[model samples]
Target: MIKAKDGDFFISDWLRNVNTLEYLSAWETMNNPDFNYGEYAIIRQSSGTNTFKISVKEWVLKTNSIGITAQAGRYGGTYAHKDIAFNFGMWISPMFQLYIVKEYQRLKTIESDTLNLEWDIKRVLSKVNYHLHTDAILKHIIPKSTLPESKKGIEYAKEADLLNLALFGCTAKEWREANPAHAKNNLNVRDFASIHELNVMSNLQVFNSEMIKKDVSKTARYKILLKSAQEQLEQLKKIDILKAVRKQNSATYIEARNKTGDELEKLTSESILDKNKQALSDFNKKLKQGLNYNPKDEK
Candidate 1:
């Protein structure tokens, strides 16, 4: 159209077509309840006539249409919504439209993969920190007794909710109740936490574990953990470390790190499981040795 018109101002001519005007007006009416039907009727009546005319700017200004825009500058041109742009592209060339579709799909795939990878990394970090947190509870909070196994699990859950309340200001059950839709999707409060929150949560786990070993009261521990969470979150916001970490942990960086046999390759569920198991085994072994040894015999 521009080649035949011998100018770069063909979109205004295209916008004046009878079918294009009607379709755009109908789209506006369907999508925007506040569409100006009065002005649309005046434009519609003049369509298909030699006197009919409308620029993208005039259409937008008169009818509040958002489907198209006109700009004036060296870097500016008429821009349309993707739906309208694709239709115009098809009108211009079918092959060009097909290429646009292919390229759009490719970009979408890359975006989806990157997002999935980041989610996976954060989930893994949360889970690993959770294991360490639980280990602390087992070692310090759960008393060694012949009590039923069910009671032990209950203690663990109760302590877990204490951390949940301290960091998230709600128990797990409370979160589930408030967000039944997310609960149905198998998500929890921590799963939706921001990167900074997750970082604070990780720090809280270690801090809480140390407090547990010190035999701090649950009430006291809650205050300490909550204060730490606030302080660390504020500190994290002041720094760009999280952004740098995200870039370093990106899919491209991870792939390169894996090929080079760097430490990033160790961030796997299996590796986490093995590390937890080894830690637990060592804890139990040391417990048994401590129980068997007698310091008085050495004296």
Candidate 2:
């Protein structure tokens, strides 16, 4: 409320201004596709006259504008969109409008910084887990003295892909083939993994290491790893703490988890032993062809 020689000033008086009506009409035109332009045009034509006046509620009802709303009760007042509210504030006091701008920007900066810090922590944890995974592979699976250096590297890759297949339901190569655009950007299957998946993968790596040390066969190890992956994912989904944390981040954890579940369902449709037999047969054919093919024997 504002004091005046006439009496008290109301927002309706400001709404009668030609400039204010034009601004509101233009804003509605740009933002609201269903805005009643004919009603707005009539309002604009009738503005800035002694006989013309419109309340916020009437404006809303006539034009279906989302920029303002009128509430009814003891505590009720008209609420305007931030843009309209800011312009109204400027109409009342330019200094107050400046303060509003500064405070809003400050709050946005703090929010952005907090989100960045959380993402960085998740990224660092993933890297640490990668080191732990590789260390486990080297200790339990890699041949030490007999294998050539090239063969040692290949063995490491094979073990890593074993984890990829168990957890993601696709080998790294298969994932790359399925997502050529992502492959072009050099992002692997794990790179797109959600925070929950990464956490589960970290645990799987350590568990697989123990299985290797116990001389567990690859087939049995995969079954155990796959079961663990599904169970841990279900538990993580139920965790309130992770849900709260993920709300601050923009990533959709539930959607990612659902996608993971779909992939696992597809993989489970086929018998694991049948798939292994097919893979082994293909490997044997490749090995036989390589052994038989010699440059000297070729014409």
Candidate 3:
């Protein structure tokens, strides 16, 4: 009761300032549908005079203001909307307003940093899971000594394409053909994949590894993988962090993993671009040879 009485006295004295009255009137006009503008104008006219004064309760009743409220009993005091309260704090002390704004910014930065860390952890996990999936294929899925000389290589490409089809709705080759410019620039489909897709892909890699160990048929595994991909991606889409992740496009590439014997290598964009240039030069030479052939020369 004593605190509430003190709060009422503070608010009444604050309301005696013409600027404070205008600020409150603006807040009420913006937020309260039923705010009494006629009463507000009369109050504004009489503000700043020695005889003029108003308590939180009187302000609420006269102007139908929802911005300020007076409460009684336990946990009771004069309360205002956060914006209004902040403004009132500034009216009393500028340092209080500065501290509030700085604290708000600090909390927001912490939230952003936490989200970025989560994304980096998930991306790293996906790459680790991919290695497991590849190892499973090498150990359990591919034949050791039974393959013919004609099919000596390209086993890894086929296994990778199966995963590409399940999550990306296209084989790696098909994606390359559809997006010629990106392919020419050495950009893979996974390079443009969203955070949600990468997260789901990580789960699918683990599932694939276990299925391969159990001798699951490619067709059966693919059907299950595709269904799981659709469901998981849809649910991840609804997460609020996804909006933040999407906005951060510049930081969103999954590092490419390459293996040689027992060593694992990370492929940088510059290295990929150099390879693309060499490949294009070789292709143009072969195309020129084909294009220059003439029937007369053959005869």
Candidate 4:
């Protein structure tokens, strides 16, 4: 589009204008912490004169600007931030600028849709396998007549926490304590799990289910689950799925509802199981059947 408008020459014309320079300087100020304001001031003072001319390269070198970049190589080209690029497009013509904006929005919508579809597919697969895991638990792990109605979910929580510990190095309760803000919103650890983690977790569910059917003890099954989680996670890390997809930004969504930066950062980071000593001890005791099972207290 720029080539058709003869923008190659227009770049210098664009830079000579005081308005263009001011916009570029303002963008740099906002985005570039190390922008050389002293040099920018000198350039601004010299603006709007026939004698005043600056190339993209000259502007970058003079002001430590990051709003635009120039490189000299086969893949090299003058690139500007979207704001500056759009402004340059407007310099070409309003119609051209409109086209760029619309095309950008179209592409972004397609990208967002594709990512959402991918995430939904992964989530569905995880849910299906989770149902299978729970079914196996019902048939094999939970005793039908040996426990009361209120205690049935205790075994479910225990098995679920077993997978949680294997994959996340934490129990469900531990995850909740460490992420109180998310807990307040009724979000769980898996709700914030990355695509790769979800994929590995889906497989872990199947493995755990099969082991349960074979009457594997909790301790024995946990060792196998942990090994599989680590190995699968390491292998999945080599895949490029993370680049194409991200954990749904549920944390960011929650943060947007008047949450602070500190809480947002904490939400995004991994929660250590050992962060709360009391919770860890409780989890250990539960695993050893030392704590009374309470289905009403299910997380």
Candidate that scores best on lDDT: 4
Total clashing residue pairs per candidate? 0, 0, 0, 0
State model 1's lDDT: 0.64
TM-score for each of the candidates: 0.61, 0.63, 0.49, 0.65
Tens digits of per-residue lDDT, candidate 3, 4-57, equal 232343667788889999998888878888999999999999987789988888
| After superposition, candidate 3 runs with Cα above 4 Å error | 1-9, 49-51, 71-77, 93-95, 122-126, 131-200, 209-218, 226-299
Name the better of 1 and 3 by TM-score: 1
lDDT to native, each model: 0.64, 0.66, 0.65, 0.71
Summarize candidate 2's per-residue lDDT along 143-238 as a digit string, tens digits.
452444433333445556567776777765566667777767766676677677778888887888888778776667777887898899899888
Worst 10 residues of 4 by lDDT: 252-261
Q: Report how far off residue 5 is in candidate 1 (Å).
A: 9.3
Task: Candidate 4: give the clashing pairs.
Answer: none
TM-score of candidate 3 against the unseen true structure: 0.49
Which candidate model has the greater lDDT, 3 or 4?
A: 4
Candidate 4 C-alpha lDDT tens digits along 1-299 = 46777435567788888999999988988899999999999999988777888898999999999888888899988888888988987887878878988998999998998788876867675575777786787678766425444344455666776777777766666667778889788777778888777888889889999998888766677778878888998898788764657666543311112223343223322233223445444544564574544322343
For model 4, what is the error of residue 60's alpha carbon versus the real structure, in angstroms, after optimal superposition?
Answer: 8.0
**Candidate number achieving the greatest TM-score relative to the actual structure:** 4
Model 1 misplaced regions, further than 4 Å: 1-12, 30-33, 38-103, 144-149, 239-299
